[model samples]
Target: MVRVHPAPLQARLPAFSTRLLLRGVFVLELATASWGGPPVQVPIGPSAP
Candidate 1:
């Protein structure tokens, strides 16, 4: 049997911050693409495989 332990809120904060950072970067890219001509190809996440 395998047991899984939930992470504490403090431990998850960094991930949340990283997500926010990614979102910000995506938005900036979107804005830049809008200003430019062609569409930008943004990956889903850091590791998209």
Candidate 2:
């Protein structure tokens, strides 16, 4: 059995938009964190897996 909570129609769009914005922010922060350390040097060779 599946049950769903009923939400007011007006709240749906705002909630979706807020979730999208938050996901974007999270991705940006993750990318910046990756860049915070010294860059890695990759030896020239066959493409790395």
Q: Judged by lDDT, which candidate is best?
A: 1
Can you give the TM-score per candidate against the true fold? 0.54, 0.52
Error of 1 at 3 (Å): 26
Backbone clashes in model 2, listed as residue pairs: none
- Per-residue lDDT of 9 in model 2: 57
- Residues 1-49 of candidate 1 have per-residue lDDT tens digits of 9866566877999999999999999999888877785865656887666
- Each model's C-alpha lDDT? 0.83, 0.78
lDDT for predicted candidate 2 compared with the true structure: 0.78
Measured by TM-score, how close is model 2 to the native structure?
A: 0.52
Q: What shift in Å separates residue 14 of candidate 2 from its native position after superposition?
A: 0.5
lDDT of 2 by residue, 1-49 (tens): 8876666656697998999999999998777766875565565778765
